[model samples]
Target: MSTPPTSSGPQLRSFASTNRFLTEIASPSSLRPGYVLVGDEIFLYDRCRKAVLSTLVPEDFRDFSLHDLDLSETSIFEALDRAQTPSLMAPFQVLFIRNIKNLYGRGSKKEEFAAIEAYFRSPNPQALILFVADHIRIPTDVRRMDYQDKERFDRIRETLGEWCGTVELARVDENDAVRWIADTAESRSVRFDPDAARELADSLGADMMLISSEFEKLLLYVEGKNRVTLGDVETMVLAAKQRSLYELTDAISAKDRPRALALLHGLLNASDGGEDAAIGHLYMLARTFRQMLIILEKNVRDSRAIWQALWQGFRMPPFAAEDLIRQARRYKSRRELTRALRLVARADLELRSSPVNKVLVLERLVLDLCAEPKSSLYEPSMQFAIEM
Candidate 1:
């Protein structure tokens, strides 16, 4: 539902690509038969999707016209077949193909590549193929993108890029993110203070998804004032600092007791209520550990799989997705994660029991969680234990 950032200002690569896509959407004759949206930066992905959906699929014929095909479940041949076959219910077909990685897995998939090339050679004039290669993460500076992701991206470019328009949906830079906050608020008739934008972007690691979500709340919070300030951001976005909790979980997963404890203390110190917020910290910790449990149980190997494994309400923030997956994999089995969850549950109970020193309760919980469990039994005798 988000619009492309204004082009009057300095354009971030992410927004620039989307703006160009929007431009293409305007001129139907100039539009590519297909486009490879090549990054996991979800905010930009959503923008491109909105553009395509609004321009191509009429609201009345959406059910028949829009196809969300995943390569994980649907084969490339079948998807292409669907594209080739005209829809009787609707005049135009808009197919969104996800899990493009499946085509490049294991074997050479020569048949699949050949099928794609054959289709694109004379693509359906009525059908718009939008392939989502979201498995790759492109930073603001793609030169620094991880080596393996680079390899996959290169392969995608060499293969799909040959026929489809390659759209580089890179991550938004911190400066661009701030500019976006201001411009977005201006479009909404709300004045976003400069300091507020900086603080908001910095605190959330310049994550566009998080930035957009929090920006919505700021708009609602300043409904009548027509202005968003740093104080409003600080008030509305306190719980979102759980990115710090992700850091703590990372340390705990690595069994770095000192770092874990340090992060725990850092979290406590940053809290508005300090000891009184121990329960809140425990709540976030418990939620994160439970999420890790689901990732471990489902064998979520990447950000894309994590989205499928975790539901909307239970999902972690965009910034924490990969970190949580990596942390979840650190455990050899489900028992270790469940044990951590049990520890969190016990700490929650202790916090509720009117303890004299609540910090110590959390500290003890962190220490125990960071230690390697001696029991290999899958089912340990622990109450309030959660399973994915």
Candidate 2:
């Protein structure tokens, strides 16, 4: 006799990518299994949820049928039991259960898991249950972690992987981020320049929630405008915390040592400025130099080729590809980029270990990077006509 099919693992699906399981459920005939959205970013998870809900319930019925359950405080047994009841007022109901710790994870009780597994095997036809995994990633001050903590987190993730169906909402990489910015702007009937979009993405770092928040603000700011520019980004998106760091990078890229040092000092003088600020400055500068180096090393010159290289290599948008190419041309060869990276690395170590002034260490590093081997640091009076 043929062996009975055995369990493999979690049937994980991705929202950004195609999932045959989800495709099969597209028709109204199939049963909708619960979902586990795994991601540190909420924007992707929220987007996945909206799509799922739209497919499950029409917009008109959402107000009456959709309900949210806070499982953190509420007992899992009670929540599951409550979700099992069919809605009298609507034909279908969507029960969104937040904080799924009780259902799965280190602290998840065994009895609850058995009950939940039973529910998954035979769920209510009229109700669609959504168990949102509470693994929202937050900033961790301790960059290095003890092995035990890391193992515990891994265990939690493994436990979450047991769900019948899952949607992993991973963070948007550089290229995807620029694409997202452009797409988001287009959707709102606003014009977003590709270069400007890349600049915005780079400036914002990996915080998609903040990126979306800024996107909304920019959309409203440019309400009647035809296009958003790099200047607009510098004016709005990079105005607050990131202003100094980005300005310093611009100065460094423009080969304006004096301006770059000025911005560095300005940042260091601020109340929040100190070792951290200096380290951040070095890190951003290093990143810029690295991108330029990549462009030069690959011999990628054309905008399309640059975009392809950047997207595949660094996840940068094509629009920003042009700017990087131009900057790369300014440096004669890989040696220049090599020297610059070394300078930053050296500064990082000095600031972390040495008793020297933080500001002085960064200033010296900047000078070394800008100085030509045969000439003094790029002349302060020789200004380039480039806009930051």
Candidate 3:
């Protein structure tokens, strides 16, 4: 996350609005002597970095002209001086300084700051510098920051604002996300249905990096087809979702406590595992319970009939639908589904509010859902809403 640069030049542009980025900062005319690309979103950051690189270094010149420097091991002056030196063989040189925030550490020298400001004021015409700062909060989400954290954030922003053309690659919100998906699919010559686009956004959260990869997979899955329907999305996308999520739900539905616990541990211990994955899992479980509640309300008994009925209403593939129908049969009454939904709701609230281990909270939730159904803890009025 990067704060907007101080008012002076039109060097800073955000990737959140694609049009603004393409029209303003992405243009060759907007290329600056030095750039500060800030954001935690690695994909967008990399994309913006590449865009700048394209303007600086041509593909053939990359071999001889592109310099990747890590500031952690080198001084700021040395890196800038090296970048300022002309390329031996290529027309222009591009220097990418990784983890640039290291240069602004507590023990940083005044000479180093002077060198940086000097380079910015009169940068080398033959070299373009990209200072990559990782893990800075954008717009400085103050609600999550303490006084010291806020101070550090402001200091970094101010320091970079003085030296480099800052561009923030902030997290993509829902509406922009939907448009991004649609536009990306269209660019790939794949027709993405509007409803399916929204569903993809809802299921995948707002991580554009992950969403982009998944969108590619979806297109490949529906090769030769002009239209990507909700059903295609349900089949192809859920297959990916199943790898991360379905096994845990299946274990719970099957009352296989050991397997469920193992899956839960895997989810919590995996590299990308954390509160976000836990929250996604919780919502999936809640959705499953809600589906079962619908089945119970309609009194659909036979697995075949239930699958057929669900096919009309839900966007799951045949195999997943069959599996869900079988799972729905495990519940003997509406109370069981209602109890599960209530448990899921309570878990959702706890996950968001409590500071306890998120994985542990989810583990407890799994235990409750798989355990025997208990009597109503709420009045009949409240039960109806959760259950049905």
What ranges in model 3 sit over 4 Å off? 1-29, 139-150, 238-388
C-alpha lDDT of candidate 3 relative to the true structure: 0.66
Per-residue CA lDDT of model 3 for 297-333, tens digit only, reads 7776665576655655554533355566667777888
Model 1 per-residue lDDT tens digits across residues 1-388 = 4544443243654478778777887787888889999899888888788878778889999999999999989999999999999999999999999999998889999999999999999999888899999999898987889999999999998999999988888989888998888988888788999999987997788988888888887888899989988767765786346767888999999999999999888777767788998988888888888888889888889997888899889887776888898998899988787788777877787888999999899999999998878665334445644421
Decide which is better by lDDT, 1 or 3: 1
Return the top candidate by lDDT: 1
| lDDT (C-alpha, whole model) for all candidates | 0.84, 0.63, 0.66
Which pairs clash inside model 3?
Answer: 1-136, 1-137, 1-138, 2-138
Q: What lDDT tens digits, residue by residue, belong to model 2 across residues 299-362? A: 9887767665565545443234466677677788777676666667766767778655787787
Q: What residue pairs are clashing in model 2? A: 175-315
Error of 2 at 255 (Å): 11
Model 1 TM-score on a 0 to 1 scale? 0.65
Ranking by TM-score: 1, 3, 2
